[model samples]
Target: MGTFGRRLLLAVDAKGYGGADAVTQRQLQEAIRRLLSEAAAASGLEWERWETQVGGDSVFAVLPEGASEPDLVDTFMRHLDAGLRAFNHGRVRAAWLRLRAVVHFGSASPGAIGFVGRAPVEVGRMLDSAALKAALAAAPDACLALAVSPTVFNDVISDAYTTIRAQEFREVVVAEKEHTGRAWIRVPGYDARALDLGVPSGAGREGATGGGEVPDVRPPSAPTAPGDTVVQVINGTVHAPGSVFGISK
Candidate 1:
């Protein structure tokens, strides 16, 4: 029978995946899978204990109950960063990869395809968050942008025992068509200088792609539409519509 227990849910998607041709997309899909395996192993995660499902340019994984979030942050994410860097080295711009990740904790019920639960759904929504996408767009030098659910952040990441520091994370509200919640963002390669820089604007230019010299043909701007509402908190104060949140960029 399939097992049921609390699990750490993780989802990762490659940025700019749809822009690539089918053949390159397939190649990148395989490469992402390989990189995830290698990164999991290098992070000292017990690969045998993880239930993984892969799509064309994304992966969903459920880690055993005892899995460590601090380990995920300090080890798995770092390994992923290094692995992607190594993979992108000497590769053409089109073949390069930048990723977005989401982590959450919840119950998991095993299924034929893999585990199924609200955790997976929540993490996927977190992965698709506008805040996460904007953060990645803002930081051109980062290879990975991670968003952690409030449960994970409070229980694991904010714990004093964890190697990851609280200052490393920025709070963001994840609002989408299906889900709305609080999440924390962290980029492995971000520096103080990078945060002050404006979002890049152009194709095939520097600061267009995350990591290395790869050129991202996609413009580095967050998606915006007329009359769309954005809710965010800056410095312990909530800013909703008609406030600074609606300020024109």
Candidate 2:
């Protein structure tokens, strides 16, 4: 007997978690737990009222009904950004906690271990999207990368009264494994408009790069292998050398 209803679903994952040593990974997991708790509290979300699940280096959270989307954006996201900034301020690059997040709204039900629903599955795909992973990798300075499903984008982010300006989000196509769909992306503190359309330096294919053109700030590094593609920052825009389509930003 599980109840069903419309809920706000969120998933957050740490980038490069697999590459870390065991001890460091454990520390990161704890940090993420604390970060989520702080973010939820700052956003006025009650911890006890929501269903939460933790896996490896990721978290899946379901917000109670009537949770304000705009508030989640303005408060939770901002607090998350601030928290990560503070955490990274004195740390080296290897210890910095970069994250990818996905937000959606859909039906869900409480299960034995956590919430079981299509919303969780969909948000997980968005979190694991290549577009998001590449975007975060390209912008080394960015602390968090976010993908919002079309439903959330249309209903919440695009609303006139939302604190998150619609212009801050850029449309992108997520093509990873079995998931192929459109999602909106935003990096809280960085200039989302300045990101280039490219995959991680070695990712095999190109996807949509939708934004204005900017100069590459950094030169392309030498590829490790003959067929390995190099990522080029042209005027401030990032580009994958072997990409079939080039989208400027």
Worst 10 residues of 1 by lDDT: 240-249
Tens-digit lDDT track of model 2 for 141-244: 99999888777777677764577877777665554334445567788766554565463433322422433232332225411111322222222322211110
lDDT of each: 0.65, 0.66
TM-score: model 1 vs. ground truth: 0.72
Those runs of model 1 whose alpha carbons end farther than 4 Å from true positions after fitting are: 1-4, 111-114, 191-249
Candidate achieving the largest TM-score: 2
- CA RMSD, predictions in order: 13.2, 12.2
Model 2, residue 47: C-alpha shift (Å): 2.0
Judged by whole-model lDDT over C-alpha atoms, candidate 2 comes out at 0.66
- Model 1, backbone clash pairs (residues 3+ apart or across chains), number: 0
lDDT string, candidate 1, 1-249, tens digits? 566678777778888889999987887888887888887788777876776666667777777678887778678888888888887888777777889888788876765544555666667667766667777777876778888877777777776446777667765544444455567778886732234223232211222224223222223442211121223312232221111111111
Q: Model 2 shows how many backbone clashes?
A: 7
RMSD of 1: 13.2
